[model samples]
Target: MNYLELDTPALLIDREIMEKNCKDMQDYADREDVALRPHTKTHKMSKLALFQENMGAKGITVAKVGEGEVMASKGLKDIFIANEIVGEIKLRRVRELAKDIDISFGLDSILQAKMVEVAFEGAEKKARVLIEIEVGEERSGVVTEERFTELLDFLKQCSNIELLGVFSHDGHSYGAKDQEECRIINLEAQRRTLQFAELARKKGFLISRISIGSTPSMIFNFPILKGITEIRPGTYIFMDASQANAYGNFTRNAATILSTVISIPTEQRVIIDVGAKGLTTQRRTKGFTATKGLGRIKDWSGVALENVFDEHGILNHQKFHDAVQVGDKIEIIPNHICPVVNLHETAYLISDGKVIEKIPVDCRGKLK
Candidate 1:
C-alpha cells in the first residue's frame, strides 16, 4: 500500500536509508577496529536490533533492564545496559538475566557495587560490571579519583561481581560550538576513560574493555583515538534534524513524522496534526546544534515547526504559510529522535513511497 494512503501523524522509516546508516556505521567501526554495539533505545524494535546485529555489531546496548529483557527474549545473547542499574528490584532483574545471557551493566558508586554483589550472591555466574567514568558530560558516573578508588576497593573484595572494564559517554559533544570543539571533547572523553582504565589496573583490577561514545563524537573522532574497545551510539541509526544540523543534511535521516497541515489559522502560521504527543517537544538550543526550530520539514527548507501544543504544531515561515494549505501532508524530521520514537506505538517501513512492513515498538514505555 502507498504511504499517503495511511493516516496522518504516522512514524515512517525509510528502509533503504536506515539500512545504509546501519551499514555505514558498522563499516566505520570495522575500519577503526572498534566494536560496534549500537544502542537499541533509538528504535526500540527487536527486529531493527537484529538488523544491526546482522550488520557486524558486536552486541546490543540498552539503557534499561526492561529493554535488555525485551532484547534478550528475542534471542539477543550479548547485551549491555549502559546506564547504572540501581535498587534491589532492578539488580535482581539484571541478575536473573545473567543466568542465560552474557549481561553487564554500569556502576559508578561503591553502594551500587555492594548492591550488585549482594544481588548476585551465590548466583551461578558472576555479574560482569563496567565502571562508568565522568568525562565532561557531568550527568552520571564517577569523576573524583577518590570516589573511583573507593568503588574499586569495594569491587576488589566482592566475589559475585567481576569488574569487566570502564565506559564513558561524551554527551556534551552534542553541545559543542563547532566540529573543532567536538574533536576536543571526543579526545578528552576518550583520554579520561583510558586513564581511568589504567588507574583500575594499577589498583589490581585486570581491566579489558574500555568503551566511550556519543553520535557527534563518534562521527568526528573515529579511528583517531586508540585503546578504546567499543563505541555505543544510538542516534546514528535514525538521524534527526538536530543531528543533520550538526553534521550536514537530512540525506542520512531515516525516520520522519508524517503529519497533515490541518488549519491555516493565520497568514503567518499553519497548524500540523502532530504536536508534542506525536512528535515530542524537544528543542535545540544555541550550543546543542544549529537547528533553528522545533523540527525540520523534509524538502521544504524554508519552513519549520516553530511551536507545538499537545496535538497541534504551528508551522512558521512565509513560504510554508503560502505553499501549505489545510489537508496538505508534510513529513517532519524531529529535533530528537529518541523521545519522538517513544511517543509512537508502531513505525511503518517505507520504500519508494510505499509501505513495506510495520514494526511494533515492543520496548516502548519499558521505563522500569
Candidate 2:
C-alpha cells in the first residue's frame, strides 16, 4: 500500500534514505577507527536497532532501563544505558539484564555507585558501568576532578561494580553558532572525556571504552581523538528540521509525519490533522540547529507550521493555502525527531512512496 492511503497523522520512514544514513554513520566511525554504537533511543524500534547492528554498529545505546530491557528481549546482546540508573527497582532490573547480556550503565557519583554495587552483589557477573564526565552540556555528570576521584576511590572497594570507562555528550554542540563552533565544542568534549579515561587508567582502573557523541558534532565528520573507542549518536538516524537547519539542508532527513489537510478556513490559513501530539511543539530557538517554526512541510520550500494545537496544525501561507485543499495529504518533518518518534505507536517504512513494512515502536514510553 502507498503511504498516501495510510491514515492521517501517521509516522513514515523513508527506507532508502534511512539506510544511507545508517551506512554513512558506520563508515564515518570506521574512518575514525572508533566503534559505532548508535543510540536506540531515537527510533525505539528493535528492528531498526538490529538493522543498525547489521550495518556494522558495535552495539546499541539506550536512555532508560526499560528501553534496554526491550532491546534485550529482541536479541540485542551488547547494550549501554547511557544515563544514570537510580533506585533499587531500576538497578535490580539492570542487574537481571546483566546476567545474559553485556550491559552497562552510567554513573557520576559515589552514592549512585554504592547502589549499583549492592544491587549486583552475589550476582554471577559484576555490574559494568561508565563514568559520565560533564562536557559543558550542563547535564548529569561529574563536574569536578575531585568528585570523579572520590567516586573512583569508593568504587575501588566495591566487589560487584566494575568500571568500564568514561563517556561524555557534547549536547551543547547542537547550539553552536556555526560548524567551526560545533567542531570546537566536539573536540573539547572528547578531550575532556579522554582526560577522565586516562585519569581512571592512571589510578589503576581498567578503562576500556571512551565514548563521546552528538549528532551535530558527528555529522561534521570531525577527527576522533586518540583514545576514544566508540561514538553514540542517536538523532543521525532520523534527521529533523533542527538538525537539517544545522546541516544547512534537509537532504539527510529520513523520517516525516504524513498528515492531511483538514480545513481551509481562510485564504491564508490551512489546518492539518496532526498537531503537537503527532509532530511535537519542539523548536530550536538558538544557534546552528535553530528552527524557524514548529515543523517544516516536506517538498514545500519556505513553508512551515506556524502554530499547532493538540489536534490541529496551523499553516499560514498564501501559496500553501492556494496550492493545497482539504483532504490533500502532506508530509511534515518534525523539529526534534527523538521525542516525536516516542509519540507514535508504529512507523510505516516507505519505499518509492509505497509502504514496505510496518514496525512497532517497541521501546516507546519505556521511561523507567
Candidate 3:
C-alpha cells in the first residue's frame, strides 16, 4: 500500500534515502579509516542497527543498558553504552549482558567504577569500560585534568575493570555559527579526546578505542585527527529538519511525519492531525543545524509549523492554507528526529511511495 494511504500521525522513512544515508556515513568512516559505530538511540530499531552493522559498521552504540539488551536480542554482539551507568541494579544488568556479548559502558568517576567492580565481582568476564572526556558539550564526563587524574589513580586499584579507551561527544558543534566553527570545535574535541587517551596510555592503561562524534561534525566531513578509532553519530541515519537546514536542503531528510489536513479553520489558519505529541516541540535555536519553526512541510517551501497543541499542528500561512485542503495528506520533517522517533511505536519504511516494511521502535522508552 502507498504511504499516503496510511493512517495520519504516522512516522515514515524513505527507504532509499535512509539506505543512502547509512551508506554515505559508512563510506565516510571507511575512507577515514575509522570504525563506524552509529548510535542506535536515534531510530531505536534493532533491524536498522543490524543493517548498519551489516553495512560495515564495526559495532553499535546505545545510550542505555535496556537498549543494549534489545539490540543484543536481535543479534548485535559488540555493544557499547556510551553513557555513564550507575546503580547496583543497572550495573548488575550490564554485568549479565557482558557475559553473553562484548559489552562495555562509560565511566567518569571512581565511585561509578567501584560500583562496576562490585557488580562484576566473581563473574567470569571482567567489566569493560571507557572513560568519557568532556569536550565542551558541558553535560557529563570529566572536565579538568586534575579530576581525570584522580579518577585514573582510583581506577588503578580496581581489580575487576578493564579500561577500554576514551570517548567524547562534540555536541556543541550543532550550535556552531558556520562550517569553519564546526570544524574547529570538531578538531578541538577530537584533540582533547585523544589527549585523554594518551594520558591513560601513559598511566599504563591500554586505551584501545578513541571514539568521538556528533552528527553535524561528521556531516561536515572535517579531518579526523590521527588515533581516533571510531565515530558514533545517530541522527545521520534519519536526517531531520535541523540536519537538513544544516545542509541547506531537505534532500537528505529520510524521516518525516505523515499527517492529514484536518481542518481549514480560516484563510490564514490550517490545522493538521499531528501536534507536539507526534511531531515534538524541539527547535534548533543556534548554529548551522538551527531550524526556524517546530517542523517544516515537505513540499511547501517557506511554510512551517507555527504552533502545536497536544493533537493539532497550526500553520499560520495564507498561501499554505489556500494550497492544501482538508483531508489532504502532508509530510512534516521534524526539527529533532531523535525524540520524535521515540514518541512513535513503529515507522513505515517507504520505497517509491509504497510501504515496504514496518520497523518497530523496539527500544522505545528503554530509558533505564
TM-scores of the candidates are: 0.98, 0.99, 0.99
Tens-place lDDT digits, model 1, residues 50-133: 999999998999999999999999989999999999999999999899999999999999878888888889899998999999
lDDT of each: 0.89, 0.93, 0.93
lDDT of 2 at 313: 97
Report the C-alpha displacement of residue 220, candidate 1, in angstroms.
Answer: 3.2
Which pairs clash (backbone N, Cα, C closer than 3 Å) in model 3? none
Which model is ahead, 1 or 3, in terms of lDDT?
3
lDDT of 3 by residue, 139-221 (tens): 99999988998988988898899989999999999999888998999999999999989888888998899999999999977
Off by over 4 Å in 1: none
Clashing pairs in 1: none
| CA deviation > 4 Å runs, candidate 2 | none
| Ten-residue region with minimum lDDT total, candidate 1 | 217-226
Model 3 TM-score relative to the real fold? 0.99
Candidate 3 whole-model C-alpha lDDT, 0 to 1: 0.93
